[model samples]
Each structure stands twice: as structure tokens, then as C-alpha cells.
Target: MNIHVEYNTEQNRCWVRMDDWRVAFNTAAEAEQFVERLNARLNAPHSWGMLSDWSPRPGAKARANLRCAKEA
Candidate 1:
């Protein structure tokens, strides 16, 4: 569940790296929150890999809906 956060100013993008390449949020604040939550998961020991992407507001919303397919 752990997550890592990184910002790409050149690309004007923010990313959240976790067990899944899920763009948790489009806004930096939102992404940071998601990253914090993901970090909490790191408290538990386990093998983990990064899942990251650069997404804008629209894309983030789409991903959100896709994540919860029923919602879409």
C-alpha cells in the first residue's frame, strides 16, 4: 500500500507511486494526500513496486471512474 510522491515541474505533472500505477489525484495537494495515505501502508513490511503516471484533472477523474467501474 506504500506510496511515493514526485513532482515534474518540466512536465507540470504530479505522480503517486504505489503497488499500482494509479494516478490517485490530479492536483498536487490531492496527490500528496494520496501519497501520505500510501506511505502509511509502508508501516507494514512487504515487497512493493512503484505505480506512477502523469495525469491531468480530466484524466484523473476518468481513472477514478475506471477504478470503480460501477461508478463509470
Candidate 2:
């Protein structure tokens, strides 16, 4: 998964995107720190594969498919 961080001039805030998750902060520095902490947690030796661990499981897949079907 890739992480994206950008500052929004119109809103005068910072935004962060990771996969389907998005977050906004009041300041660019706060956004940068959040991204840094996220990277550290993900890259730590004990949680090397933490990203993959968030993947939907079999039951979650079925629920997601059902939700999608309903939305369609």
C-alpha cells in the first residue's frame, strides 16, 4: 500500500491517504507527524507485515461483496 500526504490550500489543512483510508489535519506538521508514526509502526521489525494483516478475511470478503451488491 502507498501513503500520500498533501496540503490543501483552500482548506488550509493537510490530507493523508492510505489505501481506502483518508484523514485530514489542521496543520501540515501534524499530518507529517501522523504519516511518520504510521510508517514507523508499519516498518518496525515486530510488525513488518502489519499492512497485509489489515486485508479482508473470508467472512469480511463476503460481507463486502454483499454490501457492494446492495450499493449497485
Candidate 3:
């Protein structure tokens, strides 16, 4: 995702554009803080929950099917 911080002249405030979402902050400091937190989250490792350890039962057919689905 792309993030940009800029001042909104009409609103007299700092605004952060994260992809298609726009958020306004009363001060540039607040906007920068928000961006820092967002960057930290973006850089953090991801968790896949239950799927993290999941795998199809060992079989040629199952592996073939998985590959076909992924290609599609």
C-alpha cells in the first residue's frame, strides 16, 4: 500500500492518503505519528491463524489438484 502525508488547505489540517482511503488530522504531528504506527504494522510479520500449519493429506492427486487450483 502507498501512503502520503500532505496538508489540506481547505480544511487547514494534515491529511494522510493510504491508497484510496483519506484521513485528516488536526496537526501534522498527529498525521506523522499515525503514519509511523501504520508503517510499523505494515512491516510486522503476518500470522495466518489456523492455516499456518495446515496442509493437504500426502497424496499425488491432492498435490496435483492444489497446483491446478493455484494456477487457475
Candidate 4:
């Protein structure tokens, strides 16, 4: 897998790209920390998986609504 990092001046954010996956962070340090965690998971002996609960948690809907509003 190849990773690339770039800063977007217009957005004033840092972005990290891994193939089709790209995520933006508020700062370069945050982006770097994300990369480091990802690297650690990839290099670990055991396989790591991502699990999400479909059941709602406290404030989950509110957070989702906020994100949707921000996107709009």
C-alpha cells in the first residue's frame, strides 16, 4: 500500500491518502498521528478489523445531524 500526505491551503487542512481512502485532518500533527496508528495496526502480528454498532448510542443522532449540516 502506498501513502501520500498533502496540505490544502484553501481548506487549511492536511490530508492523507491511501489508494482510494483519503481523510482530512485539522492539522499536520493530527494527520501524522492517524498515519502512525494505521501503520501500527498494519504491522501488528494479528489482523485488526473495524466493527461498528448499528444500534444508536447517546448523542449519536445529534452528531450525525451535525455532520450532515456541516456538509450541506
CA lDDT of each candidate?
0.61, 0.76, 0.79, 0.74
Q: Candidate 1's residue-wise lDDT over 1-72, tens digit each?
A: 446777878777788876577574556997876666556665656543432343345565566555451232
Q: Kindly indicate the candidate among 3 and 4 with the higher TM-score.
A: 3
Q: In angstroms, give how far residue 68 of model 1 lies from its true place.
A: 2.8
lDDT of 3 by residue, 1-72 (tens): 999999988878998999988888899998998899889977888778845765647577556546431133
Which prediction has more favorable lDDT, 1 or 2?
Answer: 2
Residue-wise C-alpha lDDT for candidate 2, range 1-72, written one tens digit per residue: 789897889989898999888888888888888888889877777654855655455576556555431133
Off by over 4 Å in 3: 50-72
Q: Work out the TM-score per prediction.
A: 0.42, 0.62, 0.62, 0.60
lDDT (tens digit, per residue) of candidate 4 on 1-72: 787788999989999999887888899988888888778877777523423432246376556554431243
The C-alpha RMSD in Å for every predicted model, in order, reads 10.9, 8.0, 12.7, 7.8
Model 3: lowest-lDDT 10 consecutive positions: 63-72
Clash counts for the predictions, in order: 0, 0, 0, 0
- Compute the lDDT of residue 55 as modeled in candidate 1: 39
- Comparison by TM-score, 1 against 2, better one: 2
List the pairs of residues colliding in candidate 3: none
- Please give the distance, in angstroms, between residue 66's alpha carbon in candidate 3 and its true position after superposition: 33
